[model samples]
Target chain A: MNDPKSSLTQVRDRIDSIDRQIQELISERANWAREVARVKGEGLSAIDYYRPEREAHVLRMVVDRNHGPLSDTEMVRLFREIMSSCLAQEDPLKVGYLGPEGTFSEQAVRKHFGHAAYGLPLGSIEEVFQEVAAGHADFGVVPVENSGQGMIQITLDLFLTSEARICGEVELRVHQCLLSQRESLEGIKRVYGHAQSLQQCKTWLRVNLPSAECIAVSSNAEGARLARHTDDAAAIAGAAAGKVYGLKTVADAIEDRADNTTRFLVIGRSLFPPSGNDRTSLLITVNDKPGALYDVLSPFAKRNVSMNRIESRPAHTGKWQYAFFIDVSGHIDDESLQAALKDMGPVAEQVRVLGSYPVALP
Target chain B: MNDPKSSLTQVRDRIDSIDRQIQELISERANWAREVARVKGEGLSAIDYYRPEREAHVLRMVVDRNHGPLSDTEMVRLFREIMSSCLAQEDPLKVGYLGPEGTFSEQAVRKHFGHAAYGLPLGSIEEVFQEVAAGHADFGVVPVENSGQGMIQITLDLFLTSEARICGEVELRVHQCLLSQRESLEGIKRVYGHAQSLQQCKTWLRVNLPSAECIAVSSNAEGARLARHTDDAAAIAGAAAGKVYGLKTVADAIEDRADNTTRFLVIGRSLFPPSGNDRTSLLITVNDKPGALYDVLSPFAKRNVSMNRIESRPAHTGKWQYAFFIDVSGHIDDESLQAALKDMGPVAEQVRVLGSYPVALP
Candidate 1:
């Protein structure tokens, strides 16, 4: 609401008034969610406070209708946090992720669930899965892939044994930085970093601090922690991690690759209906023979279904048998997908549906 | 070679004789590789020393023909090194990988190229690609995926632009250990590790050193270095890295997930023919329309080609066009695969064949 005739003071007052209305609207929306939670909690043994399908639907709408000075992604990220704050009012969502502290997995959790969700750092990916499966946490955030690296195999292997399913997906661009509390990059005797970050910023360290002894630590945050106390040491981490340890950045965005990104999945115990645009993951093993894999995939091919991902792992059996993990387009609730899956059953030794989830907007 | 009763002096002589024979055989193999190189290099202006298809075939043969107390994988690993040594006689394979020395990428490079191939640690994945593409290196070894994590998007995205192709693949089982110069874990004040390792050993650290501050460093090797010098610091890293910095393992195999692994790709300047059992990776951008993915995939489905992996990325454009990176079951040289690609051309906006290489043995 802008007025050309308004003085500077009047404009400032109008801005403040608009801000108050926005806060009121947000509060009202949160109140509605709280009431909905109350109504849904009754007559049900358990009310799934975090409905991924519903959240996906809302985010899609927000992104689709946005026409702004702020980019669509930026708008969606803002709304996501607002929705996260609102969702917390009903019940603060508990999220488990892989970490000691300040890990990408933790960042993924914060990014997707927003500031309102309680973030719990687990020891490992399996622990994150167990935390959700055992009911200690409402949801789990685990990295499934990094754009620079390939898939995280342990996450996929865990799905073979865990009942937790994919409820949503999120991706964050990974930008590594060289951080320090030191006065300069020069005169640094040692550089601390995580293994990945060390690798990511390998050249910069070599060229900039040729004689500094490079060391790898647990996380970028941990690297920054050591950098804070060690006089001549600098840590390679992210800008966020640098702040967590109160370390100043000697150099930021030092990763060798600029477009590096990581994709994470949100896991929960239950599955829900489709959000129209969705992706489904499955774990299957085919009969160990010539053309065995072909048979297993034929059904989806015949049905005009698009298979998104198929990864193979050795079955760990002494023999050469293998297990296949697959991701395909469409939700299981869709009729055509159901028919395609039925055909997969006979050809595969075992076919377990991991989960059907909304495709990530970004 | 095994002299059951040879522990005594007389038997020791017999063992020595067997060792001589083994050395002679290896030398002979190297001589053969040298001779092969000489003949191949003649009359050919452009020569490829590292034949990924040929190496894959040999490794396959080594496993297939094995009859031993050592498992197939173990036997194959031994042969891989031996082959690497033999190939080096022609010209030591120069491989560049992401590293600050003693990184898992270095390990992967060593594992694939063997002791003879020169391993160069480049600072970035982009550098690794550039090294190979610019003819500065024979091949570049970089991680494409990890078991606990998913695909390395940087690698895939790089593939979108680089002319280098994937020729081989290798996987290393990631085992994080707690290393320190200290006598025991009790007095530990700070545990240093790579971000991945710290999380991998989170549970173990929490149980043993509840109050210890966990720090992240550049690489596990870097962590080992920090732990070696810092009296109260312990590093969670691989045994190889611990040995590099002479840090003793306070605790071994501390990763929460037992089956943690990282997958790496061998990239070179040109493509190679199939090695019987092969996997092909491709970069495909689909038309911006509903069912565009389905249409591109339908060709493979119709031909009964077993598709291995397909992932989606937003095609950096104004209207959110998407790119599909895929792995399928055969080399591009295969008739059926060629037919599938021919069919794919019409449905997709752009298609680029990444490479075809043997599936990892382990």
Candidate 2:
């Protein structure tokens, strides 16, 4: 019986059978999710199906229980996509991110919600926040900070005005590639990249394409797109973004910094229940006096709540006063955080709890 | 006194006079800086002339003493440029940043060192460190984090390997603009931008120039370069960067978020003395256990060191373990911080101080 077919064909047939089984199981899962949605929404005019804490718990389980050839992160990604499809069957989680099809913001959305969720790539972080706030999208993804670049002031400033709450956070490592339609670097008249990527790959492009004009594009994907149309142009973008246009990689990982990572926030209407490993963000305005910052932070010190991050932003338009964005370990529901928040009132002019959400696991 | 003089010309004349006075004062200051360098270098063949603490004090004084039409930040910028010139006169403070002249990293270098110093735009953050380590440059500037984007991982990762210390930090607000040599957006068939800028201006571009093929470039200045040559092309970049190439602003402040601030670090061979308002950074690898991070951070909490930021990065390849980058308030010289550092060693597998530098005053 084994002699009738080659190993390659037999393996291919096995893979097809496995895919069919996987699809069947996913369909069953979707059916259950839909049934649960119907049961939960019976008497309600509006339904809230997405649960952050539950999803976090499930993802943690996926990582914890994973015993495979695939890495835990890789496993988590696959499971999340499956969950995304299941959630979509109940009610598709409409998400917004900065988009023109192939930017990193879109990647963040896909990473967090999976491919089954709808991705609406808006023009700006503000638009993203607005769509979520206006209830057009269930949640919006926005870049909060870059490990290399620090806090995105615009996103922080938007937090001051927008009521959208931080629902979750995710990080993506940025690996830039130089992609073009041309087979070789010869006859290349120009190299296009994102400003950050261009800045990241400044040395490489300069040394390699000395005579070619280097241009800054909006996104690496956009660079790939431009490279696709222009005969003499090459683009610097991520492998995933570059792959979309079928552009060939002329140079891979052209970024100057080897570990360029970006942190993104998922913003929605309300904060979810806490995940065990969590972070609480607070925006506080300090008093106009010396040692103002010290006074604001002493409460957390007293409570021994491990602070994750503290960044100062210029308060209103052209003013000298500052507001501090503080990230501290522990959910807001935790006892230490409750005590700390109580004492924080007097020291700060204003204190707003951004949210308490699960910390990103790798 | 004012014959051919309009109000604008008279003001410009007054500015010229003030500028001449400034030049004289700056020349005198440069002489003093050189004298200090000579005095400090007297006995030693190898000399460390940069004083982060002293510069911080001076900047603080500039902010404190200003009673002005110009804001404190604006005043510090002017003084920093002047002081940069003075420092250059002493050692020519050769500084490196990821640049092709017009990116924000170059702005950061100019902001910290002033225009008088030689600006070397290297290819990457690693190259910046290499130049500084090799003594080709006195110091290198790298972006640590952005308000929106979070921490730049490459810079953080470099700290794990580099001996470079954080000497100082500065923040610059990102204000992206649409620039062109073209008369109007009407005939604009192509819009060029950097990735970050493109992402920042996504909504605006989509709404304003929907049909235009948005291209990604290496730097906004590079985009300005392309727009200068191409008839139908417009570039999105910083105003100052665009101005260098004489590109006209078709639309200013096109960024989605208003407070897109980027934080940059001045990295060098040594750490700075206490500047009163200081922040100390550390690289730590935690032991494998539950709440391992908590164990490492408890010491800082106990000492009331006021933790600033904490971020986790995967420790080596194919490993589930992580290494953390931490920032805390107070200099290493401070009593509490010194105590905290002493206690941190036992709890962590490895602990390395990145630097103790003055907290940036926005």
Report the number of the highest-lDDT candidate.
2
The regions of model 1 sitting more than 4 angstroms off are A1-362, B1-7, B38-47, B69-74, B177-190, B200-212, B218-235, B239-258, B317-319
Which 10 consecutive residues of model 2 chain B have the lowest summed lDDT? B15-24
User: Among all windows of ten consecutive residues in candidate 2 chain A, which has the lowest summed lDDT?
Assistant: A15-24
TM-score of 1: 0.45
Report the lDDT tens digits of candidate 2 across residue range A1-362: 24423543443344333333333344444454554455455532112767777677767866665443334555566556556655654345778788644456876887888755666656678878877887767788999988766889999999888787888899988788878888888988988877887877787787888898888876564576578778899988777545445578888877666777899998988977887888899998875689888888999999999998999888883355788899999898999999998998877888888998888856
Estimate candidate 1's alpha-carbon lDDT, on a 0 to 1 scale.
0.71
Model 2 captures what fraction of native contacts?
Answer: 0.00
Instruction: Score every model by TM-score.
Output: 0.45, 0.45
CA-lDDT, candidates in order = 0.71, 0.73
| Chain B TM-score list for all models | 0.81, 0.79
Tens-digit lDDT string for candidate 1 (A123-192): 6788788878877577889999876667889998888777988888998876787777775787789888
What lDDT tens digits, residue by residue, belong to model 2 across residues B1-362? 23433543443344333323333333444445555555455432112666778778777866766554334554565456545544544335567788545456876887777655666666688978887887767778999888666899898888777789888898888788888887678899888887887887888888999999989986565576578778889999777545444578888888766777889998988877787888888888875689889989999999988987999987772355669899998888899988987888788888888889998876
